[model samples]
Target: MPDVMPLVTAVDQLADRLRSLPQSRLRQGAAAHGLDLARELSARAQRLEFPDREPRSVPDEGLFVVADQVAVTGRDLAEAMRTASAHEVAEAVKLVEEAARRCEGTG
Candidate 1:
């Protein structure tokens, strides 16, 4: 089974990136939303209930939600970067999307 820690770490890194964006209604909203999703995912990962056996996979629904949130947050970040002509930030957002896809095993 693949480790889920990488996915959680990626989500945390994306959230940090989002939080560093310039303050604006869109940025604030997206960052908050993404962070909340990341937090929930992290919590779920930490609280797996299987007692005697190692889990074989992450929940598909949880992966889907993470992917969706990452896409939305990336879009929001791209839009924020566009307003400031921050091409580097836009690229970084793309990377975040890629990481999210990888996490979902869809990359």
Candidate 2:
């Protein structure tokens, strides 16, 4: 059989990462954006097992809540991945310093 192990592992990790997002905070933002974050999460959580068949159906309310939390957590991880692509601490530090400078006088 084909080596599907790696793919399965990746999916599980993705699912886990998604589940970690903070739904409570994201929910309010999602609402403003006309998104149903919880629904998105539930849908993703249903895929945690990485089934070969079509994903199982998730309840709207439950999914939305889960999805919201997942999104928040996922976003941080995604940003870290992208930042890593920059390939240097100096570059990352520069970005952080710039961001900090933006709020320096305001707070």
Q: How many steric overlaps are in each model, in order?
A: 0, 12
- Candidate 2, position 89, lDDT: 27
Q: On a 0 to 100 scale, what is the lDDT of residue 18 in model 1?
A: 47
Reference-based lDDT, each prediction: 0.42, 0.35
Candidates' RMSD to native: 14.9, 12.4
lDDT of 2 by residue, 3-102 (tens): 3333233323434533453565334343222123223333443343343556444343442444344344234323333323334323333333332233
Residues 5-102 of candidate 1 have per-residue lDDT tens digits of 33335545665554444445223244444544444433333334333554333233332244455544444333333333344444454555564443
Q: For every model shown, what is its TM-score relative to the native structure?
A: 0.33, 0.28
Task: Give the CA lDDT, 0 to 100, for residue 57 in model 2.
Answer: 41
lDDT of 1 at 61: 39
Give candidate 2 misplaced runs (Cα > 4 Å). 24-58, 61-107
Residue-level lDDT for 107 in candidate 2: 18
